[model samples]
Target: MTLTHRLLSPLIVALAFSAPVVTHAATDPSFVLTATSKNFDNYFPSYLANGYFSTMTSVRGSEANLAYMVAFMDYAKDDIARPAAIPGWSGIDYSTGKSTAGEFWLNRTLLSDKAFSDYQQTLDMHNGTLTTRYRYTDDSQKSTRIEITTFVSQADTHLAATRITITPEFDGSVQLSFPLNIWAPHQPRFPIGKMTGDEMLAAVAANNMSVTEPVNYRTADRAPVWYHGDTNVSNDDGSTKDLTLQLDGKAEQGLHMAEAAAIELPKGIKPSDITLDKSTYQLALNMKVPVHKGHAYSFTKYVAMSRESWGGDASATAALAKKARSTGFDKLLAAHQTAWHTLWQSDIVIDGDAKVQQAVHSDLYYLLSNSTSGTAWPMGACALTPNYAGHAFWDSDSWVFPALLLLHPDRAKPIVMFRHRTMQPARERAIQYGAKGTMYPWEADPETGIDYTPHFAYGVFREIHVNADVAIAQWQYYLASGDSAWLKANGWPVIKEVADFWVSRVSYDKANDRYEILHVTSPDEAYDDVPNDSFTNAAARKALDIATAAATKVGASPDPQWADISKKMYIPFDAKARRHLDFDASVPHDKITWMGSSLAWLMYPNLDLPMSPEIRKNDFDFQLEELKVHGNDPNEMMMVMLATAAAEVGDGKTAGEWLQRNLVGFLKPPYNVRSETASNNAGYILATSAGFVQSLVYGLSGLRIDDNGLTEAYAPALPPTWKSLTLKHITFRGKRYDITVDRDAAGNAKLTRKAL
Candidate 1:
C-alpha cells in the first residue's frame, strides 16, 4: 500500500460510526480535557497558550526537566540572517536537563520506590487553566497529595502563574523548593551559509573551528552557538582560564533575554532558607510547611519573560512579576477567566453530537488563544511550534482570519493590520520583482516586516496569489465590520495597491480579447508555473471586484481596469464537461499530492467561476472518488473545502461524511488539537482548526458574506447526526446575530437568524 493509502485509514474507520457515540455533552460545565500517562507522549506534552506565551509539560512531575516553555518575541537579527530557532523561556537551568525533578516534586520525601498514583491533569478551556493532581506515599507510610494549577494570563499578556497546593493524610512537615533564574540563553541553530560575515567570525572564534577560504564556505549544518549562563560553566568549561574567557565575552549582543520571577507564600508561612546558586544563577527556596490532615497549604509562583530582541525591558519584567505576586493567584485567575469568558461569547453550538460540539469548542479556544486584538503579530500556521519558522502565510488571511472575522472581528483586525504595517516591505518586494503596486511575500516576518521565505523555496516569486488573499481579508473585514474609518485608513491602501498589481500582472490577449495570469503556483502546490490557475484566477477576479468597491466606499477613484480585468479574468473551465479545470491545460482526477479543494474553494468561498449544480456534483464526486483510486490523501483544508462545497450543493450526506473524515483524520485525542495531516507529523496547526470551524459557520448554516451583509446563500445542509447546529454571536455590519440550523421531523434542514 502507498503512504497516502495508509494516511486514509483513519478516515475509513470513521465511516464505520454511522450512529452517534455517547459522550459527555459540551454544555456540561464539567466538560474539560483530562490528560493521563496514556493520553500524551512524554516528549511532546499537551500545550497551553494565551497569545503571548505557551507552555507544555508532562503529567509525570519527575520529567519536568523536559517541559517546554516559549514566549512571543519580535523578530531580530541573531546568529543568522534567516529564520532560526530562537531562544525559549525554559530558563538556563531548565535547558541543561540537570534538574531531573520539578518545583512540584517533593524533595527526598517519597518512599524508596518513589512511585506516584492517581495522577491526572484537567485542562479547562473555559478558564484557560491546567490543574494537575497526584498522590504519593512517604517513607513513613503517610499519604500526601499535591495539586498544581497553571495558566498564562489573558488579562496580562506578560504574566504566567502556577499555584501548588499540598494536603497531608497526617500531620507532617514537608520541604519545598522554589527556583528563580534568568531566561534561557540563545542556542543558535542554522546553516552556516545562512549566517552573516560577523556571525561566522564569532562562531569560528568561539568554537575554534577552521574556516579557511571563508568566501567559499559550503552551505552545511553547523552546531548551535552555545550561550552559557554562569550555571552552565560546569558543563562546558575545562580549564579555569578557558572558563573565565568564555564567561567574559562568549555571549553575543541582541540575544539576551530578560526574565524575572517571584514566589508568593501563603499567609502566615515563610521560607526556612533562601539561597542563590552563582553557577546556574538559579535561586532556591527551602521551606518546611506544617500541614494537618485534610488541610491544604499553597504557594504561587509568578514569572515574566521578555527579550531585548522583542523590545522588552528587564526592569519591566521584574516589576510585572512582582505585581502578579502581590495580586495573588485567585485575583489573577479571576481576571484571566473573565477575559476568556468574554471571548467565548461568540461560539459554535452543536446538538445531538457531543463529540463534534467538543471539537468545535477546542478549535475556537486554540484560535482565540493564538490571537489578540491589539497586536500586529499574526498567528502562524502552527501555533505551538515554530513550524515554517514562525512566519505568517496565506494561511493567516485565507483560513484563520476568515474564521475569526465572522466570530470575533476584534481579533481578526490585527491580522489585517499586520499586513498594513508591513506594506513598506511589500512595496519593496514588488519593486524587487518588477511588479506594480505592493506585493506581499509568501512568508511574512512579523518583526522585520520583510519576506522571510528562505532562498530554497521559489514561493517568494511564484506564489503570487498571496496578494489577492491579503486584499480579500481587508475588504471582507470592512464589509463585516462596517468600520468606514478603518476602511479609509488601512483597508484602502492595501486593496488599491492589490488592484494596481493585478492590472499590471495580467496580460491582455488581443486575439482572444481576455486577460490571463501565467506562471503561478496554485494553492494545490503540486503544479507550479501554471498558466491561468483556476483558484488564482478566481481569487484575483474577486480581489479586483473588492478593490473597486473599496475604492468607491473610501471616496477614492476606482481603478478603470479593475472592472475590465475582473469581468474578463481567464478562469480555466471545460464547457463541454461542465467542470472547472485546475489550469488551462489540466486533467481531471490527476494524482495531486495536495489533492482536492483548490477548485472547490472557488465554488464555496469565492462563489465565482459560475457553475451549475450538475457541474458541482460532478466535481465533488470526482474529487472524493479520486482520493481512493490513486492513493490521494488531501490536506485538512481540502477536506473542509469539499465538505463546504458539498453542503453548498445540498449534499448533506456527503458533506457530513467529509466532516467526519476531517475529525478522524486531523484532530487528536483528549485535546482536539489538529495536525496538518492524518499521520500527525506537525501538530497544533491553527489553520486546520480554523478551516474546520469555518465549515460549521459558513457551510452547515449556509451563511455567506456579500454586499447585503451576512445573508443565507443556500439551504442549510447539516450532517444527519447533527440534530441542530447554531452559530452564536456572529458579528456583521456592526450587529450580532445568532444563526441556528435545525432539522425538522421530515429530516430537512432549516435555518433561522435572530439579531442580538
Candidate 2:
C-alpha cells in the first residue's frame, strides 16, 4: 500500500458517516484569488490579575484584593493536608499527589484568615468610588489605634495616594508594616525541599514546574517575633491547639498557624467580643482579651493601591491591579467585549447560517474572556474564574498559536513574547542537564518560573518535548509576522540554543543509521518515556530546519558538523501502517485510543507538516469514536483543534458538529453560561472563539496559510441552516483579507474577497 492509503484506513471508514460524493463543476478560479480584509475595533483588557481574585475598590474608595498568598512552605504541612487528597480539587489526583497538602485547602485557609479574609466581594462601579474596613485588637493594656485609608487613580494607570493614621490611648511602642509578597493563580510558589533561587529560575525557564520554591517574599526587616505560649486554634481537624502565639506588645507577628485561635479572656471581657478600638491593651496576646467594647473593629484597606505602597518598582503589579480594580472581575472581560464590538463593526458577520454566526461569536467570547495582558502566566483553562492554578504549557504555544496568529496578531505577539522572556531560563536548564540548548518546561508558574509538577508519574521528569515546542513557536511567529529583524535579534539566539540542546540530547542510533530522540513524552500524558516519538521527531526536525534557515540568513553558523547532524535526524513513519509512528519500533505502543490526535498537535497551529486527506479523515474518525460524554471530558482545547481540522479538509457538517459539541458540553453548560471545563476560564474563551473563527474561515471560506502563502482551495460550504457569511480584516502575510459568503434564493453560494 502507498503511504497515503495506510494512514487513511481508519479515516475512510470514519468519513463514510458524512461524506459527500465528489462532482466536477466549472470552479471560479478568479473568485478564489480575490483578497479581502477586515479590521476589528474591539480589544479585551486583562482585568483580573489571575481570574480567581478580583481587585476592586468599594464605594468609599478603599481597595480589597488578595494582598499576599503562600501555600504553607513547609513540606511536612503539605503531607498532612495534601491538595489532591481533598475532594473537588481539579487536576490533582491524590494517588499521584506529590504535595502533602493540596492547593485548594491552602487557598481556603488564606481566604478565611483575618489578614487575607474576603474571597469574592463585589465592587460598586458607580463613579470612581472604593470602600474597605478591617479591625484588630490587643489583650494587655498597652496602646491600640485603628487606622483607615482610601485611594483612586486612572483606570489603566497605576499611580494612587493612600491616607493612613494611627491613634493611641496610652502609648508604649508600635510598628506598622505591610506584606509585599503577592501571588495569583498559576504563579504559586514551589514547596520547600528542592533547590536554590537560581536553580528554580532555570527550571522555570524551560516550562518545567517540578522545582522547589516557585514563589518567595522579600522581607523589609529581618527581626524575629517573641513567642508567648501555645494558643488553642480550631480547624476541620477538630483539634484546638494548632498554634503558638507570639507576644510583641508592639512588633508584628507572622501568623502561620494551621487553625483558627480560641483564647481565654480576663474577668469581664469574652474572647469572641474582642474588637479593635482606641485603648491601651496588649496586642497579639492569647486570642482571649476583649480589647474593644461593643463594635467590630473595622478599618478600610485599599487593595488596588497596595502594590504601589513602597515605590515605582512595583509598577508591573500595580498596573495589573489597576486593570482588575477598574474593569469587571474577569481577565480581559471588558476588553474582550470591546474586541467583539470591533469584530462586529468590521462587518465579519456570517449571513447564510444564523447558528454558525452565534457559534462563531460564542467561540470569540470564550477566547476574549479567558486571556489577558500584564500577567506572567499563560491563559488558564477558564479565562473568567480561577479554579486551576494557571500554568503555561505546550498546548498554548502549539495548538492555540495558529488560530490566534492569523486573526489576532497583536494579541498573539505578547503570547510569543512570554516565551521570549523565559529563553534564558530554558538555556540554563539545558546546560544543567549537560545539553547545549534551551529546554521549555512542561508546566510553569506565571509570576515565578517555578516547576510545579508534583508527580513523576505524570512524566514531569521526562518532559524534553517542551524545548522544541518553544522553537516551533519562535519559528511560527517569524512566519506569520515576516519580521526578520525580530528573527535575527530575539528569535535567532533562542533557536540556536534549542537546536544545540537537541543535537546534544539525541543519540546516534547505530543500528538504524539515524540521529534519534529517545525516551521523550508526547503531548498527551497517557504515553510516557516512548522512544523516537513521531511528534517529537517531527518537531525536532522542523525546528532544526527553521533554525538553520533563519541562522543562515542572519549570518550565524554553528560548527560545520551541525549540517550533517540535521540531515541525519530521525523521524519515524510506519511503512506498514502508513502513518507517523507514535515512537520507534522497539517502544511499546498502547493500543487504547486518545482524543486530539488529528489536528490538536499537527494541523491547527503547529502546521509542521500537512497530512494527506485520507490520514486526516482517519484521525477525525478515531477522535469521534473515543469521545467521552461526561466526567473527565478531554481538554476543551481538543474541540478547537478538531473543528479547525474539519474545516481544513472541507467537511462543514463535521466542523459544525464539533463546534456545537464544544458549545453545548463545555462552553455553554448545565451550570448556566459558565464554562464546563475545569476552572481555567480563559481556556474556554480562546478555544471557543478560535473554533468559531475556524468555522467561518476554514469551514466556509476554506482559507489556509502555509509556507507558500495563503490558499483558498474550497468555496462556501454552508451548513443546511445558513444563508450568508461575511468576515473582515482577516490577517495573513501581514495583510488583511476581507471576505463575504452568501447563498442565493436557490441556495447557490456566492463568494467575495478584497484586500484592505
Top TM-score hit: 1
Model 2, range 575-653, lDDT digits (tens) per residue? 6655555567786544432342322455554543557777656555545554542113454556666766666666666
Per-model C-alpha lDDT, please? Answer: 0.65, 0.42
Q: What is the lDDT of candidate 2?
A: 0.42
> What's each prediction's TM-score?
0.82, 0.57
Q: Across residues 139-247, which tens digit of lDDT does each residue of candidate 1 receive?
A: 4456677778788788887777777777767764556555543234445444432454355445434543454534211121122321112111112111111111011
Query: Model 2 off-target regions past 4 Å?
Result: 1-348, 352-363, 369-386, 558-569, 585-600, 622-632, 668-701, 713-718, 732-734, 741-752
RMSD of each: 8.3, 17.0
